[model samples]
Target: MAASAGPVLSREEVDRALARLGAERDAVESALLSLQDHPGLRLLDGADLTGRTQERWAVVGQGLPMLWALFDRYSEALASARAVRARKPRPGGPELAELSELLTGDAVTVPGGAPDGPQRLGAPARLVERVSLDGLMDRMNAWYATVLEVVSAADAVWTALPARIDLLIAELRRVQTLAASLGVRVGGHPLGDDLDALDADLGGLRTEVRSDPLALWRPARVPAQRGTVPDGGALATPSGVVDTERFDLAGRALDGVRLELENLLRLRDDAEERLQGVGDLLQRADATLAEARRARGEVLAKIAATEVPAVPGPASALRERIVVALELRQSGQWYRLAPLLDALEDAAAKELARARQSLTEVTQPLAVRAELRGRLDAYKAMAARLRVAEDPEVVERYEKARWLLWSAPCDLRAAAGAVARFQQALRPAPGGPDDGAATGPADLVDAVDAVDAADGTQQGGAWAGGEPADGQAVDGRVQGGRG
Candidate 1:
């Protein structure tokens, strides 16, 4: 009995103990792998396992419970291996080296185990102690084959779970970026609530797995077979366990991605629609502006046509007469034809008035043109008014002035120029004599009164010349006498 007992272990026996555990893990792993190729071991049917395997028809129902137990045990061993790996001392440490040796080398005896004897698995009544490699391999292989079927069935569910999560994360980032660009919050229906839910579920699953990965080692209870221990529930069975919750999470993530993508597509569609409408509106506005410009051009053309022909004739005649009068006066001969000179001044004034009026009328269309000029000036003034103006009022006043200059009823400057021209034409010729006997003043006043009465009509027709009333030229040069 003493020889059968294993070597004793101490507090510092951690390395040796871990090494033994590793050997045991490896032994189980090898046995499970060998069993994969075994024959005559019937796969468990409905009685085999839980979760996904029970639905198959080829596996025997009687072998399911054992298979379930075998797989459960295998899961436990795998989880232990992961835990031990996590806790192993640093590389190059004696403990780590011991664990490595146990994993790849011969089994080590520890605590109560025999140093050179076969390892005792457990109490003889609890489990078979010296299972034949061939026999056990055959049994495990049959059981695992059924579990492999379960693994295949659950593959999409398991694999898709994490994939869905990854996709969800990517979509979430995309939505966040889009929301930022549009200057909107992310709390609305697009991906907000769904993302929140998925995040929470994923966090919970991660926490659960971190807390105890071995929790999955327990056999899953089938909804239909509540209390029965299926044969396939054995930990040593070759059943592949999948993280189903991960699949669920992934499904949700995929759903979120789909929804988010749909939202993005809709946003694009809406932007396109708005852009189309804006384009149409701009086209209409451009067309309207073009028509207005054409109309303005036509108006200006008419004014020019009316005023052009009359300009040269009257203006030139008046200038020539003024020059003649000035020359006569400078030669000290103006007293003889003082009345004629006065008449000339009056005629000159009338001609100037007409010229001015024609010019004013021709330029009236420019007020509309001036409107555009004023707007441009207003834009220029915007920078200067920042300091002097309290607000935009100065800018506005400047704009209004410009509008007045350009808009319909001609500007004050235009009207004033016309009046000034008329007044200038009424002035007595500079070299003419200022004698009381002259009817020049009276005739000129009457002419102005007539013009005033006619609402300042532009003079174009011949004037009524003042003479001796006997058909004699007042200045001895009668060449129609301004009539």
Candidate 2:
């Protein structure tokens, strides 16, 4: 509000002030027309507004007509001043003084309020007030800003929310179809429950958005100190924005649906791979069991050891479970089938492992006896190559070892010891009399003879059928003294 104490305007000064007021009038008219034509304002007019926007807009809407009425009055007063000045090329002192009073003083009349009307813009009757040109412009500007703020905020929500909601709804439909294929129904899965909730929330939100967009807006604050009323009331700041909470909730729900869909796809791939793995495991078990049965026959014929382990049959129960799981997958019972497949695969692998272990156990004694026979034959061939196969001690050890190794019900322990003795009879002494030129079989035979003559004296019981712990030859023959 301007103070009334200032120097009086001369004729020229009054003329200049009138020109400035005229410019201000032009600007105000243009601004008002712009506000009336604004797209946001148009949308607000058509929208079924609710909540805080509805309350604020009602007050703001009442004031809009008053803005134009005040502007018309301002134009009329300016036109009167201009006509009086035009009566002469330049106005006289009295005319200038009157114009100054009109520009500076309370010359504009706002109509009187009803006796029991609501205060502020809500009042139906025009409130009587007299304000200067500058004061009226300030009030108009403040009201303009307040109304524009609310209109723009609501328009923004309408523009942003509805289109986004539609897109999410489209995506939700696709997911629902996929969920149906996977047998993910509302009562069966938590994903279905979440989807149902999201559908309801989104449907309601879209309807609310289309109908009452302003209801979704959350203003940051009504800013204070824009301007003060003549009645000393502070003009509050404009409301800012649409609430983000609903938008955020909708986005999160869509994300949850997307994540679950991806999980279902991964489960589908895993289920197929595991099914194949189970089949391979069961097949391997059958092969291992067959091999074990064959090895049992071989062990009975070759190995003298009694009580060979029996081969286990393939696990038919686990195979049957795999068939059930496959049927479930084919029928699209994925949730029920997934765990069953896992259990089947694990059982099949264990069964295969058990069969392999049984086969190894059943064949092990035969394997040992075969190894002993191989060692006996290899030693005899080595003795023949050395030409010590006919040496009396070498021949005797070889014959006794052969009898134990080649005979039925062979004592593998005795056969192995006899073979070891023959091997010892063939090796030349480390530094004996025939240590020289020993590669030929005759020198090797003589080396054995020399080691036998020493007889636990020269070689520390290493050769010559060394006495057992009971001090007799192990084969129950005399230690052959060198001929």
Candidate 3:
């Protein structure tokens, strides 16, 4: 219902509008310069952008020059109006009428005018119906805003991606060097192959990201609320989103390499421990063999009748294996050294145990003779305490056992039988004339008899009250049954 024409301005109103117009021009000029000098805009101009960013920038590039052209036209119109008012001390009715038209009316003119009239800057084909000074300013502000969106998006992608890629590349190189030192070849270890593949992939991905950042960006659509008519929504941001999945994959690959390195270091430590154990076992075996050799000479000289086993010499073959294992450890072949050290440790322990067994076997008869001598004297002292050392049968058996046991080239088999017979004589005769209160000697005899029973002997008369000298009922004859 309002008139199509602009409202008329008095002199004061014209002057006020001019001041306001000049302020708008200054602000607009500052905005234009800032947009032109913006880092994002500079990057957008020089960068080899791609995909949606490339397409959008092409449109923005075309629109930018048109926006500048329109701003120039707006500036010229304001200047001409200001000059007309400056000619008089005060604007008259005629002067005010002309100023009113310039201040509020359609004032911007396109140079090389269209066949119809003034037009939008770049779209000369579509003639502009009418544009006032204020309308032109609004159009320029819109163009500036749209161009800034594209420029900022490109700059944001550039800022976040390239530096991150460089850091990842540095980490990848460090891992690659470590892998090579560990003998992890591309075709040998799966992790090595994976690292190699990642190297190639990261190289290509970095190039792609640098050259065409927008192509890698993901666009997420925010869901509209239910039960509301959805308006055409602007994007949350025009900037490219980083390809986080690829970066995470790269980080995971490096972590795997780091884990492998840790495992190898642990293996190296275990290998060193195993080598130390192998050395200890081999040294113990050598010492055991030396002791066995010394015992062999003593056994031959003292027990003339016994055949001594020859002490085995140090295990030269096993020693050679230890040398080889040590070499493997020095060479950093932890995998190879681990199994070798295990085998060497087992073999060395067996050799040491065998040497000890040989020494025990070769000197066994001498030990038995010594044991028999002590048993004979122990029973003699026992019988003397019991007032029965002068028993003729016991003396005869004792002397026979002693001579066989004490003489060099002692017949140990005969000596063992003599000692057993002497021990049997020391037992109290069942229903024979040897009854009295039990003494310490009888208790000692019972203790020796208990030992004999454990060795599968069934002695007839060791205890004064007899149940075959033990608690067992023997052959239905209970000589000393509990009352």
| Best by the lDDT measure | 2
Residues 2-120 of candidate 3: C-alpha lDDT, one tens digit per residue:
12246568778888889988887877776677777878778778878766667666666654576678778889989999999999978787777777777777766654322221123
**Stretches of model 3 off by over 4 angstroms after superposition:** 1-5, 87-89, 92-100, 110-129, 215-245, 262-270, 278-483
lDDT of 1: 0.39
Estimate, for each residue in 104-146, the C-alpha lDDT of model 2 and write its tens digit.
7666665554112122445545457776666666766665555
- TM-score winner among the candidates? 2
Worst 10 residues of 3 by lDDT: 221-230
lDDT against the true structure, per candidate, is 0.39, 0.68, 0.66
Backbone clashes (count) for model 1: 43
How far residue 400's Cα lies from its native spot in candidate 2, in Å, is 4.5
Put down candidate 1 lDDT per residue, 332-385, tens digits, no spaces.
332223444556545644554554444444334444234334333433343232
Clashing pairs in 2: 223-237, 386-441
Once fitted onto the true fold, the runs of candidate 1 whose alpha carbons sit more than 4 angstroms away are 1-168, 179-190, 207-237, 240-246, 249-257, 275-483
Among all windows of ten consecutive residues in candidate 2, which has the lowest summed lDDT?
474-483
Cα error of candidate 2 at position 139, Å: 0.9
User: After aligning candidate 1 to the native by TM-score, how far in Å is the CA of 45 from where it should be?
Assistant: 32
